[model samples]
Target: MIGRLNHVAIAVPDLDAAIATYRDTLGGEVSAIEPQAEHGVNTVFVTLPNTKIELLGALGENSPIAKFLERNPEGGIHHLCYEVEDILAARDRLLAAGARVLGSGEPRLGAHGKPVLFLHPKDFLGTLVELEQA
Candidate 1:
């Protein structure tokens, strides 16, 4: 089962401007900012009560988010991340339940610097799911 609705990732073309807009105009506070070197993307996390807004964009050609932005203009919501007590357990259950992993099972430093993984949305009925261990 999911522990909490951790964060919602929004793919934006301009990370800085998005940060400014969310902070200055929308009144959100910066929670965590990290560079996902593996994914070739930089992220800015804006925190709100009971939820977070993650601003994601590509830093290089290998970024998947960059490709997503290409097809869809006006950079929008990417995926939903939920906090789980055990990522491996979740993965195992998901696998047994007919879900497939989009990437390797190895953990990567996520938005909050915690380990995370993305489950293939095709297997999840079009909802990209992120499994994160707390």
Candidate 2:
């Protein structure tokens, strides 16, 4: 059901600083910041040979990232995304396996412009898992 690792998402309180750290300090090829209003986040992708690193910052006060930042002031890894050949099929399989899918269990447009669904963190060893349609 799951394919290659799509990207690792990190929640950051300061988007600019995180961008600089990855771009200037780490010498990564960073993409322009793209605001994903539907997802309530402003994202910056740091591309690498094997995979990508996603820097996510809250877009509004009510953003989920804002709540995450409230819990973790310093910010940290938010989730791990894996590509899936068929998102709906994957959702059904996860549901049958007793895994809790976040939100409505329907795929939403992700920062990468792909259909994505989030799974409950507790079900995946405390790490939030995101399945993106490949």
Candidate 3:
């Protein structure tokens, strides 16, 4: 089962510009950029009162975000992350319910250093969903 909403991820073509928009323009507290090579993304988290916003930039040409940016030059909301008490259990439940899990069907270390799994976008009404362990 899903818990609380974690963070919404947005893919940006320019990471520095996005960070400035959130930090300077929006007056949000932005965290330092962290390059997640495993995930092929450079991330910056914008902290908010209720939840956080994840700014994702392509780490390399092969990055998945690069493909996303190709389709959407301006970038946009990429995924919605939700917390789960037990990620493995949640995966099993979703599998039994006919939902498709992305990648190797295993949880990976997310930006928050928590175990995270991504579900197929098609399975979630064309919206990519990420499950992060609480």
Candidate 4:
């Protein structure tokens, strides 16, 4: 089952501008940008007391974020990540409940270096949901 809200991911066309908006304008503590080639994204984490905000920029032309930006030039919230005690168990439960899991239906290493799985957006009321191991 899902646990605490892990982080909300936002896709941005410009990574630096997004970082500045969160750090300089909003006065938030932003972490250094980390390139996740495997995930095809360059990420910046804005830490907060309760949760974190993940800023994602495309790493390559074929990156999913790039495609998302093509559809939404202004960029917006891409997904919501929730923590799970056991990712595999959660996947199985969701599968049994007729929820569709994205990709290979296996967990991949996420920005936090935790196993993460993405669920179909339509399955969760038109919002992409990410389940990360707690």
Lowest lDDT sum, 10 consecutive residues, model 4, at: 60-69
Pairs clashing within candidate 2: none
- Give the Å shift of residue 21 in candidate 1: 2.3
User: How far off is residue 67 in model 3, in Å?
Assistant: 0.7
After superposition, which runs of candidate 4 have C-alpha atoms over 4 Å from their true positions? none
Best candidate (score: TM-score): 4
Q: What's the number of clashes in each of the models?
A: 0, 0, 0, 0
For model 4, how many clashes? 0
Clashes of 3: 0
- TM, every model: 0.87, 0.95, 0.95, 0.96
lDDT of 1 by residue, 1-134 (tens): 89988888889898888888899899889745588787678988887887888899788778978778997667988899889998888888887988787777776777567889898988777878887897
**Ordering by lDDT:** 3, 4, 2, 1
Displacement of the residue 49 alpha carbon in candidate 1, Å: 1.7
lDDT tens readout by residue for model 2, 1-134: 78999999999999999999999999999988899887789999999999999999999767888878989888899999999999999999999999999998889888777899999999999999999999
Off by over 4 Å in 1: 31-33
Which ranges of candidate 2 are over 4 A from the true structure?
A: none
What tens-digit string does per-residue lDDT give for candidate 4 at 1-134? 67899999999999999999999999999999999988899999999999999999999768978878989898899999999999999999999999999999989898788999999999999999999999
